[model samples]
Target: MRAQRKGPRRRRALITGSLGALVFALLTVNILLGSYTVTIPDFLAMLGGRTIPGASFIVMETKLPQALLGLLAGASFGVAGAIFQSMLRNPLASPDIIGISYGASATAVAAVVLFGVRGAGVSVAAIIGALVVALLITVLARGRGGTGLILIGIGAAAFMQAAVTFLLSRADLRNAQDAMVWLSGSLNSANWERVAILAVALLFLLPLTAAGSHQLHGLTLGDDTASGLGFNVPRARLLLTIVGVLLAALPTAAAGPIAFVAFLSGPIAKRLNGGVASLHLAALVGAAIVLAANFAAVNAIPGISLPVGVVTGALGAPFLLWLLISSNRANQGG
Candidate 1:
């Protein structure tokens, strides 16, 4: 019995450690391979507050904040995705898929195109939009089951996407270009302020997520079973859902809903962990995916830069199709 328990624990540890290492490596590559290359020694010097000519400015101002944002935002999206999937017991139930990201995107696009809002104003709008959409889903699905929530969310997302398209069509040339880039999710605007906002948000939200995660196991066992186990099923579900929304929103605000990081991270992490829900591992995987995608966007295709969302979409679409097909086959089998 002791060895049996140890085996799984050891496997979990190995998986977590491997993911952490990968995230670290990708972060290093993201920082080092930007427009102006910064060698390891110069990077250390910048961290040490020593000025090193052009290297200092590029490393400190541009690459560092971008890398940091990718790390935090990716982890935020990943953990949020894991929470929603685990709670809903559906791999397709990520915030991006359900409409939370579309909510943020629609509002942010409106702010930019209609009211000419920029900078922090757009971020604030995005957070509010995500929260409102989440609330609507919760209220609409109140008496219904997880499937109901998923269906409602999908409908809501389509509505939000239509709003976004209409707003973009009405915008002028420059604003439309800007909105399109943001909708596609780029870290081009990454700065210290954005990094600080995400860092602080995560500081508060991560604890809430961790505290509530254990309840997920009970919730996953089904509502009746969870209630019988003395869990306040509705309250727990609501709190976790709110946490997940916040997690998804903060990153969207900072980075413009960076495609499918939230959608892909949880399922991939589960596979890596041998089919167990590992939020921590998922967070690491999310961070790595963002960094790698960002890196590829900048460096993979010579003489042309793409948005991080473009790369993530290319990677996630196939996975999404596979997941849908597999789930359908499984249902048919059942």
Candidate 2:
């Protein structure tokens, strides 16, 4: 028994260490590979608070904040994704895939294009939108099961997409361009302020997520089983869902919906950790994905810089399709 327990712990440690190293390496590469290159010496110097002429401004103001946001937002999305996937007992039930991110996006876009809202106002609008959509899904899927929730979310996403399109069509050229860039999840607008907002939000949400994660594990055993074990199944589900929505909303507000970071992170982490659920590992994986994707977007294709979402969408779409086909076949088999 001791040996078996130690074996899983050792594996979990190895996985966590690997993910942490990957995130650190990606973060280093992201900070180092911008328009104006900052050498290792210069990076060290900047870290030590010694300005290295032109490099300091670029590194400190531009690359630093961008890398930080990617790390923070990616972790937020990853943890959030893990919560939803674990709670719903379906890998396809991620915030981005279903409709939570879309809910935030639709409202933020409307605020930007229709009411000319920006900055903090837009963030607030996004939070409201996410909460509203979550509530709607819960109500609609009452007693229906995970499949029902997923189907309802997909429908809500379609409606949100249409609303975003209509709002964009009504806006002027300049506003439309801004809206499009945001919708595509560009890191070009990243700054210390935005990073701070996400960081602060995480500081609050993460503890709640941590506490709720235990309940999440109980949930994986099914509601009746969990209830028999003395858990309030419905209350636990509601708390976890709310935490997941907030996690999804904050990042969407900070960096736009950023494609499938939320959708991809949990499965990738689960795969890496040998099918064991580790929210910490998932968060790290999420950060790595966003940071790596952003690095590729900016540097991989020479001369043409793409939005982070474009790259993520390109990667996630195929996976989404495969999941759909597999699920369909499984249903048919059943």
Candidate 3:
């Protein structure tokens, strides 16, 4: 038994270390490749202020902010995904599927369209909207099956999408264009200001994520078991949901729904860890995936850049469909 445990431990350490190294290398490559190519030494010189103006401005004003936002957004999505999956005890129970992302997007869009709010104020509104929707779903789904929650969340997502569509139809062309850009998700407008906002928000919430990680594990044992284990299941659920909402909301507010970082991160971590508890692994994988995707989108093909979300959605949607199909197959087999 001791030998078996030791082997797995060594393997887990190896896997985690490999992933960490790969993510770091990908991030470095991502920082180097963009609209303006910066050689490693030149980039270093720019950072150290030994380079000329043009490359320095491009590096300082553009690539840096985009990279930072991608990292934060990925990390947030990954952690949020793990929380929801553990809490609901379903691999598919991620924020994107549960309407949390839509809830935040809907509110942020409303603020932009109806109230003319922007920036940090829109982020605050988005968080509120997400929490409200999450609370309602939790309340209604209490004592009910996961299927009911899934159905209700689907309905909510559809409604929010419809509302956004209607608002876009009525918007002027310029505003519509802006909304379209947001709808698709872009890091083109990333700036130090947005990076700063994400930094501050993460600083406030990351400690909370760490503190609640153990309770999150308890939740996987089901509500009754968790309660018997002296966990306050309801409060735990509420707090977890709130944290998930905030995590999903901040990036949505900052960069729109950048697709499947949330959906992909946790499951990838689970697969990587051979189905271990996925708190820290999920966040790390999430950051890696988002950063890698952004890098790929910008640098994959010369003169053919795409919205960052496009790559993630293209990859994420298929994974989600496969998950659903496989789940149904398992149910049938059972």
* Candidate 1 TM-score, C-alpha based: 0.96
Instruction: Choose 2 or 3, whichever is better by TM-score.
Output: 2
What lDDT is obtained when candidate 1 is compared to the true structure? Answer: 0.90
**lDDT of all predictions:** 0.90, 0.91, 0.82
Per-residue lDDT of model 1, residues 83-172, tens digit only: 999999998899999999999889989888999987778878888899999999988988787789999999999999999999989999
Top candidate, metric lDDT: 2
TM-score of 3: 0.94
Candidate 3, residues 142-184, lDDT tens digits: the string is 7677677867777787887887888888777876787777777
Of the pair 1 and 3, which is ahead by TM-score? 1
Off by over 4 Å in 1: none
Q: What is the TM-score of each candidate against the true structure?
A: 0.96, 0.97, 0.94
Worst 10 residues of 2 by lDDT: 33-42
Q: Root-mean-square deviation of each candidate, in angstroms?
A: 1.4, 1.4, 1.8
Tens-digit per-residue lDDT, 1-334, candidate 2: 9999999899999988888999999999999876667789879988999977788888899889989999998999999999999998899999987899999999998888889887788889999999999999989999899989999999999999998899999999999998899899878789998999999999999999989989999998888899999999989998999999999999999999999898999999999888877799889989999999999998877887788989989989999999889989999995
